[model samples]
Target: MNPIDTLNLDFRALSTFLAVLDEGSVSRAAVRLGVTQSAVSHTLERLRQALGDPLFVKSGRGIVPTRYALQAGPHVRQILDDLQSLSAGPPFSPATAEFTFTIAANDYQRDLLLPGLVKTLRREAPGISLQVIPSGIPSAEMLRKDACDLIVSPHAPEATDIMQRGLMADRNVVFYDPDYRKPPENLADFLKSDHISLVFGTGERPSFEISLNARGLTRRNVVTVSNFSGLPEFLRGTDMLATAPQLMSKHLLRDFAWVPLPFELKPFTLLMLWHRRNQNDPAHKWLRNQVNAVAAAMNKLNP
Candidate 1:
């Protein structure tokens, strides 16, 4: 379409296009949009003339998006999301704000960063509350579906609409009970010893394990747990080694002794992730800033 034709397009037309695209029928879309079927037809006719695409085609007893409509869906959604953010109005005030922010995080991140964040929120925004859920190898859908407002994870799923910021970097370390076993002395010793590791709810192994596998190495996983909280209990009496992020030493794994890994593996960055739709929201921006500040403080103390 030419620029002049595009100028004729407006938010109402775009919104109607989305409604039809999502609901799959003009009647259904009209119902969802609280408009009559003729109104939807009129808007779609304008959209068709402007965009020069039929957008949707009849398929079986229902409607299906044409190639052009499928391609335009994400862009349309993004535009509408951006426009909605403009209505957020005024800066956020934490002191009097009373609302809860939900975050998705595994036990490791929940322990390492959130407690500090909670303390800060309590002091500065006492009226604000937080609810946290486990993030098992986070996916973009979690943010897209609004399952959580934020995610704290070492694994960031790749997607254009998802945004991430580095919280901290941590290296793999070996944790074991000093009374039950001595540290691995070499790569061979590490391989020979029985191991305990974390397997997320999705049955995906941790990045450290993936790195080891890439190098044609494997460990004898004598025990596997769903979350970091289960590690110490299994490692306490057994002569087993648990390789995990070094920063965990300050919290969850503190009761157990940890040492640098016997071999080198690149460090991984823990990240905070959110959907692009929330990018410009004033309250969300303030919450993100608080998370960053908490991570910064942790990095300074740990470093």
Candidate 2:
């Protein structure tokens, strides 16, 4: 028989053949497959005609596989396994894949996460390029439209349909200049101090204010900045104290002094957010794992 002609056999027939072989009876195979016994027998007939072999035959009460059927079973099983892996998408190969990933993160994250991530990428996958953008309205929209690959943020917006994984936990710290004398003992004292608020964008301000209102204190914002990088600079000359993620403030505290926020607030969970479309993508999965690993390592070091 020509090889091309042999390739014309129906996959359904092969599946039915395997089912019958495994079940040891057509009736059992039909029940397993939710089909009539006659249909299973008919499928076996077609498979036998295509292969030019009596793939299985009656031997007493149970069906017996012929030599050809026994030989073909493992090969058929391997083929099906390979097809299933392909459907799920194969594992990522970082060395050969030339792909660009766009990530959204705030400036504080850019300071803490990107430095270590970049060093690892340079050593491992030099071809993969990364674009980091400010996390805000644009980032949320980009994620929804599948324009951005991932987002690293303290809190994910509820409006977007994105999957989030907690990367690291950090509390909000109140940062002040070293020479600033007033040390706050509680929420009332903290509220009395001038504050510099870090606003990602216009949308974040309302939610942030609402969260503060729930605590029975309204933030009397002396100044608002677009990025966290400016917070350190803004603190140098003014009495204004800044509230930011602990990890980011930890890096800044090398040159400045800070204290824990007096009011009881939830610890910030920095999360990685990605659209559902790329949830199972091999390359995307690899990147997500790398980020998770880095965050885990950093947490271990700090804790």
TM-score per candidate: 0.78, 0.65
Root mean square deviation (Cα) for candidate 1? 5.5
Q: Give the TM-score of candidate 2.
A: 0.65
Error of 2 at 70 (Å): 42
Please give the CA lDDT of all the candidate structures. Answer: 0.87, 0.74
The list of candidate 1 runs beyond 4 A from truth reads: 1-48, 51-82
Residue-level lDDT of model 1, residues 1-303, one tens digit each, is 473456455678877888788667899778756789999999988788777789988899988989999999999988878786778876789999999999999988999999988998999999999999999889877887788999999889987568999999999899999998888899899999999988888999887788889989988998989888899889988899998888888988888898888777889899999987688888899999999999999889988
Pairs with steric clashes in candidate 1: none
On TM-score, the leading prediction is 1
* Count: clashes, candidate 1: 0
Assess the local accuracy of residue 254 in candidate 1 as a C-alpha lDDT between 0 and 100.
Answer: 89
